[model samples]
Target chain A: MMLKYPNGKPYKPKNQTPEQVGTGKVKDFSFGNRGKTLEEEINETNEYYLSRQIAIVHKKPVPIQIVKVEYPKRSAAVIREAYFRTPSTTDYNGVWNGYYIDFEAKETESKTSFPLKNVHEHQITHMKNVVDQQGIAFTIVRFSKLDRYFFLPFSVLYESWCHMKKGGRKSIPLETFESKSYEIIPGYNPRIDYISIIKKFICNKEC
Target chain B: MMLKYPNGKPYKPKNQTPEQVGTGKVKDFSFGNRGKTLEEEINETNEYYLSRQIAIVHKKPVPIQIVKVEYPKRSAAVIREAYFRTPSTTDYNGVWNGYYIDFEAKETESKTSFPLKNVHEHQITHMKNVVDQQGIAFTIVRFSKLDRYFFLPFSVLYESWCHMKKGGRKSIPLETFESKSYEIIPGYNPRIDYISIIKKFICNKEC
Candidate 1:
């Protein structure tokens, strides 16, 4: 069965495994992926972090607009009708070493560019709010075709978003990601060691 | 219709408004409440803070486990079967001036004591984790019978939890909240001004 977004658009689940890049020279260091989705990898990494007492991050549960519910006697209450609501903020957020961390994760099939349409306007605004409140905000974008993951800071994404408003490029080119964002190498224990990258930039400087 | 918890117990929706305590000496400062629930009041307060760019706190959406959904040919998807899952963390968490704020809100009808059963063991562990990570963790308890609210710190709650584990009292006396926690008097515009209390404690010293 298929699910639909609030706008009646078919909700496309980005649960596909990473595709092998045909380039023979490129080294595949992401052996831990094991055909897992980006979300799954991140969850695994978060569990690893939590167990180690390093961080306390969690993916916010999917927002559902409950319409009708049935309460059967001697049983649990079952939701009979509900609809998906458009989230106004990012997907993942939590405290990390006394710093607020907020970010959204997306997996794109396009190898050349990451489309701005993947993020909603409210989420951009929400990220701006987080930044204004002195919280760390960013996006984790996985170029599935290339098996490459980039941690795009909110600043870079916001700049591109503003440029898009002025009729600029519809998407951020892969070259920009290569230049501006930090590449998160997939590993075995934590799966995706994105927090190491965050610590290097945030902890060493502002935090 | 009534809802049920994960344990098949009838889910109690604590949406009732505050009642009069019948004490002639008690001045009714909560003019803005307008018979609203503690959750609604806090949501309003968070909105006020967000509008003024003071803090970015939000009540997390109810965690629902989606079992079955149906998508119509030309309409929004409908959740056919879903159940409310036991949340493993606090209900509210967000960033406040770069500080990670995490807390749970509960209202008790009892006038003498607040029962510990209102909070789950997993939530206590989660709060401990947040505090260990240097994040600000607390609980907002509302005495509906007395129309009073208090911000109980995690340390105090943890102590009580440990004591209870040692076969101590199962409930926290109302006097403990009066002395140990900060009382949040309701007001207009923001309704429950809890962040001011947080700022006084956190910003003055550590922040």
Candidate 2:
């Protein structure tokens, strides 16, 4: 059954994974298929980091607008009606060391490029605002097909988004990202040790 | 209509007010009845701090689970079915000068004491976890009727909550707060300047 919005517009899920797409040239890292998705793995890694008192970061819970609820008991309340709220910013934000860190994580099957549509306008604006306030803003883009991850700065994402708006292209070329972005090699313990890269490259010098 | 939880137990909306009823000791502070709430005022204060590069703090958005939505072609999306999700932590958290700060803002009408029930179990647990991890955790209690504010540290809150569980009392006495807590005098620019107090007490020694 096709999902349609109240106004008859086709409903599109915000973050959908490209399932059937095969892996590309990028290296694939496994955190074990313990029924945990990439997002969940990243969340666990964040928890690990928090537990170690190494950094303070958290995934912002999905925003929902609740309308109706059914109270069956004192402890468990079941929601009867709800709708998703479009977030104004990325999925994750916190302070690491002395810098404010804001970022979103996305995985894609496309080998050649990363889609611009994956990054929402509101998220871009939010990142711009953070950068304007001198906060560190970036995205953790995972080319799942290639099993590769890159931390792309907000500045680069902003420029690419503008280009896309001007009818240039819908995706950022892989070559462009390779040169400008910091590549995050996955590890066994942390799964995605992107912050280590950040500490080595960004925070060490800037802070 | 009385609200009942899923377990068939009647759910009581927490009556959060000062413990000493009608003492008229706690002062009153207003954000002006201009449609903006205490949360918005705090958000504005955070923005001010961000602008000045003094501190980084934010109010986590209320979590909701959305089951349905409607998208009108020319208007904003309307949530059709939604329910409120229990938050696992305090309302606000961030870092300043390398010290992790986490807090919850609550308003009450009574004058003598703050109700222990004003806070949730999960929030208390989260605060305890933060404290265990060596992060600063506290609550910003605003006596709306009296227009007074106090920053009650997690250590004190945890102690009071434990006592309440042991059938000691349902609230924390105002006298106890007045003696142990830091009184935050409201101002025009930054509505609640708790960070300044933190700078004086916590950050100066640590950072």
Best prediction by DockQ: 1
Each candidate: how many clashes? 0, 32
RMSD of 1: 8.6
Score every model by TM-score. 0.87, 0.69
lDDT of 1 by residue, B93-139 (tens): 98888889999989989999999999899899999999998999999
Candidate 2, residues A1-207: lDDT per residue as tens digits?
Answer: 455543233453323233211111222344373434567668767878877766667777665444455656543355554444555567887656656677898877799999887878878867776776566788998888788888888888888899989888899889988987888888777878877877765754477
| Candidate 2: C-alpha lDDT | 0.70
* DockQ class, candidate 1: acceptable
lDDT for every model?
0.81, 0.70
**RMSD in Å for all candidates:** 8.6, 9.5
Q: Report the number of the highest-lDDT candidate.
A: 1
Instruction: Report lDDT (Cα) of residue A135, candidate 1.
Output: 91
Write model 1 residue lDDT over A1-107, tens digit each, in one string. Answer: 56655644455334322221111122334555667778878988898999999999998888876656787877567788776767767888898888899999888
- List ranges where model 1 is wrong by over 4 Å: A4-32, A203-207, B4-32, B203-207
